[model samples]
Target: MIDEVVMLRHGRTQYNLQHRLQGQIDVPLDIVGQWQADQSGYALASRFYWAKVNRLATHPESIAQPPAAAAERTDINQYCEAPAAARRMVVISSDLFRAQQTAHAFADLLGLEVTCDARLRERSFGQWEGLTREQIKAIDAEAYASWKRHTGGETRYGVESRAQVGERGAKAVRELIQDPRYADDETSTTMMLVGHGSWITATIANLLELDPDGMNALGGMRNACWCRLKVRHTINGQPADRPLFELEEYNKAPAIADSADWENGPADLRGSSMPDWCPIIW
Candidate 1:
């Protein structure tokens, strides 16, 4: 059965660097984006070894600290030598170029193939697809004001509403868990869904029955970063009709890339252009 889900946001693109609305434009990853994806692959795989020693956050100290004593060293080496067949790792990605690129990186490391799903595409921004905030303000002042105020602006201007994005994304996830190939698996499965920012937030919120509107309570996830969720088929030892997910980690960057992160808790200038605010549409 699928034991866990990792929702990873795509690496940055030219549009992301420009602070423009990517929507369904399907932009390619920039140079730094490529580095982020490559490093994430190494870090994610190393977790199989580090997880027994450290928490899942992948913070700066995860790789820096040494074993306390000889016994601890032996334990870590043994954990690293565990048989690979104990678990299965798979990657599922949005059909968009950016998401697919990131997925391929992680899949290559695990020697797996990437399954692309169009439903995981970013929320359609309609007429604002390729425009920046400044351009949007100049074109449609009223719509811009409502969006800035976070009062359901996307519902207007032909853009896809939050509910619409949430519905499609959540359905995609639920269907995957029900599909026999994954749900009926003999070994535990770790499935990573590489997708866009807004779609990931909306889909997860909808899954958890939280408000999938405006700002996300879990906050914006950084580019090439991921959140861990535990998939449960039972509650209190009783079988559940459907799968339930528990949030284990939220918005954790790869420890290998920790040096690139700013003290402000965002990536450097070359990383994702997500401002403290322009989080949703971009």
Candidate 2:
């Protein structure tokens, strides 16, 4: 059986609202961001129901009551049996607060513990840590543009080179899979990795064997978006291989309403409101 992996970006942050480059900065989720995380948990719960349906169908004897009678059971416990011996699940996240928080939400829904791995943190921006693109241009326009165009260059401005980011991110993911907990599992498992935009994008591109230019064209990732991957393992003791880790989903969180478009005052607001604490990315 193959293992399934779910990659989720963190929720909105203060820097995201102000258009700042957050790289490695630890920021907490805003109120709306927290709500979105909760909603994500709910979505996972719905998926759990469908998974249960599939599992139950595979074992007819387990159902004492008739199909119609079982369907009428109000409690979800009737369908919450453990998966077959051939399946398992796990959740992990970067040590960063944002990623940790997002993983926490999903862990709650899956009834699994979250493991924070330091190797999964975002790329270190070095000197460019908190500056926005416009700000970087003002400081060193030529160098910034050159860095963007070139594949690898000197990190004079304290920014991480694209190649380095990709290398580190990929290494982290490889290490995680090699861990005994995941490697020894005979059953298929679902693993969720919550991390930053650039690092996650670079890792995905590397896993797919895409060139640097191709990854660049893919552009920035949106908050709370996710990617999915399926990794296949040999029935024998050979090393596991990933046939493909395709982009199964993209940006999907609910959009925040523009306050300026509202005719009524804030008191009468009925639409989605942006979180006051975090910066809105979109």
Candidate 3:
């Protein structure tokens, strides 16, 4: 079974820059988005290095306490090279261009192939797929209003609702758990899912049994950002039968500073507030 799941939203696209709804449109990543993918991939790869699980099975004493704490008892075989009981890594992506491109960056870093799945694709926005938000509002104000209210607008358009996306995504993951290729009691797996913002948010909300559509509920991930979950994070007993998860991180991107960061955007230089947040890492 998967112990830790890292769900990343695909990098930004031209549609993203124009504030357009690109649901399942197969758009590609823009320059900044590509840079973000590269940076985040490096950061994620470094996370495995720093965890020092690569030596867990052979030299478990090198790691203080239990190496399991760092891995959630999962196996990252290529990265960690642990025994059958160790952790392993798997990369999966939405069968969309944007998501595959993003997944490639991370997979290349890990020297792994990404498995694409249509179930992880963005919710089909149907006729509104290529339209900008403002354009949708102008074209059909009532439908937009219904959407904002988290009501049924799917009946009017060919759109897939949050519920549909959630169920499809959850089922895909459960099927993976039952698949012999990745799931076995001997190995804990660290799975990375590259997908669209809406799909990832809805899937995670469904797994946690929370409301993803509530006005103040789970928000969409920023382009190339990610959220981490402890899959069925249990203590004292075995993992849950369901695809349960506990939110560990959300809307998180690589904080590595570069010469290009904090440039051009007025929002970046407006003296941001930290909001009393404390992170485990300084």
* lDDT (C-alpha) at residue 166 in model 3: 86
In order of lDDT, best first, we have: 1, 3, 2
lDDT tens digits by residue: candidate 1, 70-131: 45432343333456435666678999999999988777654566888888899999989998
RMSD values for the candidates in order, in angstroms, are: 8.2, 6.9, 9.8
Best TM-score among the predictions, by candidate number: 1
Model 2: weakest 10-residue lDDT segment is 256-265
> Candidate 2 regions off by >4 Å?
48-86, 147-154, 215-217, 234-247, 250-282
lDDT per model vs. reference: 0.74, 0.65, 0.73
Better of 2 and 3 by TM-score: 3
TM-score of 2: 0.72
Q: TM-score of model 1 relative to the true fold?
A: 0.79
Model 1 spans with C-alpha error above 4 angstroms: 48-83, 214-216, 261-282
After best superposition, candidate 2 residue 16: deviation in angstroms?
0.7
**Ranking 1 against 2 by TM-score, winner:** 1
Residue 185 lDDT (model 3): 68
